[model samples]
Target: MEKKLERIINNYLYEDIKEIQKSENLRNLGLDSMSSIELLISIETEFDIQIPDSYLVPGTFENFEKLKETIESILLP
Candidate 1:
């Protein structure tokens, strides 16, 4: 799942996961409103899970690690 997430981020945002800081902000990664929406859609499609509005807030998508954690929480028991 982590690898898939990284690939989606890399493909959509055009940043290499190996080069990205875990704490780097998504906005700093060049994510605008459009890309952010596309990223959310990609996440749901990749993981085959529906993300609730509660997880769509700014803090949840703050960085790569946070986004991974958010999806992890949703997918894992």
Candidate 2:
């Protein structure tokens, strides 16, 4: 599941970037509000996890990894 999420993010982010570890800045990699929303939706579809609206705040790719973690905890729990 982690690999899947990493793959999805890597598809959009540059390859040079390290795998997301809950601390990387996705925004610097070119993520935006719409992209974030789209990514969020993709995660839900792929993992069947319902992400909270709170995780979507302040739209930034940098926040993406954390969002993934948040969703993962919910789905895996």
Candidate 3:
């Protein structure tokens, strides 16, 4: 899950992903409408879970790790 999350972020949104100290702001990583949509789709397909529209917004992600955790939490039935 961690690798998948990292791939989604690095492949779709982040070109400057770091081993440490990456930015917390999605906006800083060029999170426009298209990227957000791709994120939503990739997460849903990869996790086999539907993310509510309310949870897909920038405010919900907080940071890359936080986003990964949220997805994993949803996966843990």
Please provide TM-scores, in order, for all candidate models, with all chains considered together. 0.90, 0.70, 0.75
Q: For each candidate, what is the lDDT? A: 0.84, 0.66, 0.70
TM-score-wise, the better of 2 and 3 is: 3
| Candidate 3 lDDT by residue in tens digits, 1-77 | 77777777776555555553444676567667777778778888987899876676666555677787778778884
Best by lDDT: 1
lDDT of 1 at 63: 85
| Residue 37 lDDT (model 3) | 79
- Candidate 2, residue 40: lDDT: 72
Q: Model 2: how far is 66 from its true place, Å?
A: 1.3
lDDT score for candidate 2 against the true structure: 0.66
Model 1 Cα displacement at 11 (Å)? 1.9
lDDT of 3 at 25: 71
Candidate 1 TM-score versus the reference: 0.90
Off by over 4 Å in 2: 16-22, 59-65
Candidate 3 regions with alpha-carbon error over 4 angstroms: 19-23
Mind giving the per-residue lDDT tens digits that candidate 1 earns over 1-74? 87888889886565786697878888887888788889999999989999999878888778889999899898
Assess the local accuracy of residue 29 in candidate 2 as a C-alpha lDDT between 0 and 100: 74
Candidate 2 residue pairs in clash (backbone atoms < 3 Å):
26-61, 26-62, 27-61, 27-62
| Per-model root-mean-square deviation over C-alphas | 1.1, 2.9, 2.2
Query: In candidate 3, where is summed lDDT lowest over 10 consecutive residues?
Result: 14-23
